[model samples]
Target: MDSIEPRNIPLTPGVYLFKDAGGHIIYVGKAKVLRKRLASYFRPDKTLTPKTRAMVRMAVSVDTLSTTSEKEALLLEASLIKKHRPRYNIVLRDDKQYILFKLTKRHEWPRLTLTRKVVRDGSAYFGPYTSAQAARDTWKAIQRVFLLRRCSDTAFRNRVRPCLYHHMGQCLGPCCLPVDNARYRAMVGKVELLLNGRSSELLELLQQQMLDASEALEFEKAAELRDQIAAIRRTVEKQAAVLGSERDMDVLGVAETSKGLALGVLFVRGGVLLDGRNFFWSGLGLEEAPEMVLSFLGQYYGPQSVVPQRIVIPWALEEQAQDGSALPVMSDSLGLSDEEVLADSDDPLAALAEALSELRGSTVRIGPPRGDAENRLVTMAQTNAAEEARTSASANVEEILAAKLGMASLPHRIEAVDVSHTGGRDTRVGVVVFEDGKPAKDQYRTYAFTDEESGGDDYGVLAAWMRRRLESGPPWPDLLLVDGGRGQLGAVMSVLEEAGCGQLFAVAAIAKARSEDSNRADRRKGGVADSIFLPGRMNPVSMRAGSPELLYLQLIRDAVHDYSLRRHRKARAGSALAGELQRIEGIGPSLAKVLWEHFSSIRDMADASEAELAALPGIGPAKARRIRSGLAAMRTKA
Candidate 1:
């Protein structure tokens, strides 16, 4: 059968490898004592799963990576496992998607922005904030607090006019105006300190700035500064202060129920629990107590993003902590000696057995807490794990949305459309998709109106786009959303009915408020109150704000607006280019195409000399002179 044998290597602190019968390294383990530790796997199984038995059956040979101490071995184990991600090991897949604070470091006045991806090429980064809303709020706070530059590099370099951001008090207009480099760098340094939990220092500086502004009779600016300082102070005061604990510490707690196992981690940075997350895995078969804990720790700490000064785990991880391959241990409380702290003599089965027995409503035994403090911490860990599990369940959302909206389905997929243009000048349509209550960006589409009556005919633009979409035959959608009230809906419904596709999907229209302004901040201001006009209903289904359906509806509308505006802007640029080229006597559609392809842009064509224009494929010397003259005339007018 399985012909694997232990190397019987001395347990003088080293890394060990377990190879399957086929000589594939199935699992790698480490221990302080070479002989006594490696021999424990052969003992009678307590509650090992079929998977563990299978792994054992495949074990053919053992290998070791010798080290001077168990700590070194433990260190090495974590490194190798991170590199390999062995099958038998626990894998914690934490969502890496987080908000990033991007700063343009190359510019003299770097702009601060919130982005999803971080490129670490000398730019400053702060965050991985839990939510996009939270990130946006923080960004707004930063702007009010420190008026950082927000322009793009190209805009900053060539800007001649102060933009709207300057008037709104959001940007300092450093792009066009000169700013002292020393002062700008100082602000950057203060941002670094503020993010690093030195809010006290930042507040002091803000206080002085506020005083300076007030004394200079800049009352409005001083009031704004005061508000910003208060916001920063309020946020800092929310940080939880641990009793006599160092600023940096990672607290680990493990809890298990019949449903699965949970590892709850509390990361304390600068003595504050800014954020935390939970990890859970199906506990099908758990044989060795230390090994299970070891496996979970390996997966949890594999990422380079988070590393703590000290770790507090439930059980000893000696074999794991040795060769820098495992979870490093600051200390262990078991009766094992200082040297044996990293040894494999400790057994946790008795405590787990008692806990499981109690959980099963039977007599059980467990390790007594060293003190009440330790016991309370353990309970807190268990509560945190349970809460994390409950919060992360995806099933409840569907049921909740259904009950709230009285809908057959959760309305997981929604399609929204908005038509954009000024007086139908550049009539363009935007289509947006929302899936599972969020905007599904990849499914967004846009349509530029080919035929439309000039000046304010919403129905005409919508009808054209609708007809084109039907003819083009894009993916059929779960729902069709119209941005206008009755007019847009009537046009869309009529087109679909003509195509014999009226009953193929749900159609609804969201109309803006008639009396109240559409752009107002008041949620209730917008109308026909965002009424959902169903296919047959002469009116619309009205829902209250904060309802899940209402929230989902708002997201769809917003996404469509964003898409429509972006498409409209691009179409406007294209139209402007075409109109400019059309003015040239020699530039018909063919000559326009040649000029567009040759120069790649309207600006380039306009900037080109007569010689460069003559060098183009179809432009003769006489035509080039005409082209240059036309461009010169447009530039003069502009």
Candidate 2:
């Protein structure tokens, strides 16, 4: 690896990729003046941080993608970072999409539902809630207060009678009953108001409605409205009001602690603190704060992500020239004339705001806090970030694990594997991943094995899984935990050794404790603890029964075990369905696969009409009729 010559780089607004000797991108960055940014890395006098110095040492070459403008460069950088996930970049490991509340607009009987994506489907979306549970809680609260339809359009159309919700007086039975359209529409309007954070106005309307119902002697209606008002009030009371006016903005606060750098964002809608989220990165210091902040904004507020109109940060994104002193014209370094350098050197803050404004489809303001109220909000955010950092630092889970497990380094990313099968059929190997002591659900994966490959042999399944895992390649786990004792560990180790990558990752196995009387595996009975065995070890590691490290491993083990069993069951069900479909005349594996892809379950297939079946890719009218009749006969036999 050799240093990249910065002089050869073009002076343009674009993204740069620093590739290692293996041609793998280790870092991705965007720069307004590409030559100047690259020069900083190659300058002898510039003292680089340890991380940067290491990145430079590993870099053998540089790749650049020129963009038309700085804003385009910013977007391109985020896209590349997400795709490549370079080692030196501040990658956000939480890949779960934000939750949104979708309200159907075109449907005559609109229903509210939670979705992870926002599409241009003529529906009103309310939020990008960071927590699924919080979004569900809010949706449930809204349902309790409003009598809107709760079923999907398909279920609403197919319903024969009112559901249990209607019986419980929670719904107006719009699906099967003649509910007043005007009243339902009005309720929908109120729900919109509540979601938009106009609860005060909605409360007034509800109060007025209750009075009118009382004057009309509609006692039940008036009492229901009163309950609705109370519920809305209780919900609104939970939010803390921090602004004098109804302005929606997001406040960002950064905190650097011994553990890492933590960034907290508070979502303020209509002057109330709706929700807040904290992101923490280990080993990052205050010196990288500006870059971290910029990267966070670019990654967090993605294309489908919701962007607030205003964003307040603790400090400026870039240091401004003080006392009206202008920056030195980089005509020579940038290979541009003085006029061009002056014109192209737009303030990074303004460019970022412009990019966000375009994404939001409205004007967006980004800057430091101005007034006392905003200062207080920023302070609150900073306090939250500091608390999060302190909590993360106190845990020290990785340090304890490293000491107890006798590992060469701290196991930051752990992957656990478990094999499941039922009498040599539908074998499945589930892999669960944990990063930074938390479950990374998106990274969890499952592999299937043929009956011949498994043969009811756990060791054989493990070996097959290891080979497939090796093929998948890097972003390899720090430690590989298997769900068996010495035999299983050996199987995995043998595969790795045979593949000539024995030292790629550490391997360990967990075995259930045996009962003394029966000498049978005691599955968590009578306080029996599981044993963990490393490769070539005859005995288990000495970890206390309820130690955090032991509990964490147990947690990972249980997760993979459950995931494997679920996958095994699903595979069995799918196999059974395919076999049954194959038994029918004129149906083969391909048609069965098509049928399975179209229908979720056997019951769903049974309920499909002939016309519906005929609409499938290859199933013609004759095959569709045969399929319908076959399913009907199968159901009758059942």
Models, CA RMSD each: 15.5, 4.2
For model 2, residues 217-272, the per-residue Cα lDDT tens digits are: 99999999999999999877887778988888999998888867888889888787
Worst 10 residues of 2 by lDDT: 319-328
lDDT of model number 1: 0.62
Candidate that would win on lDDT = 2
Residue runs of model 1 more than 4 Å from their true location after superposition = 1-40, 46-51, 58-87, 95-97, 100-128, 152-164, 212-221, 233-239, 243-246, 284-289, 301-304, 314-316, 320-381, 390-638
Tens digit of lDDT per residue, candidate 1, span 542-608?
6775665565566667778878988888777776787668877988877776776576565566667
| lDDT of model 1 at position 164 | 90
Local accuracy by lDDT, each model: 0.62, 0.80
Q: How close is candidate 1 to the true structure, as a TM-score?
A: 0.48
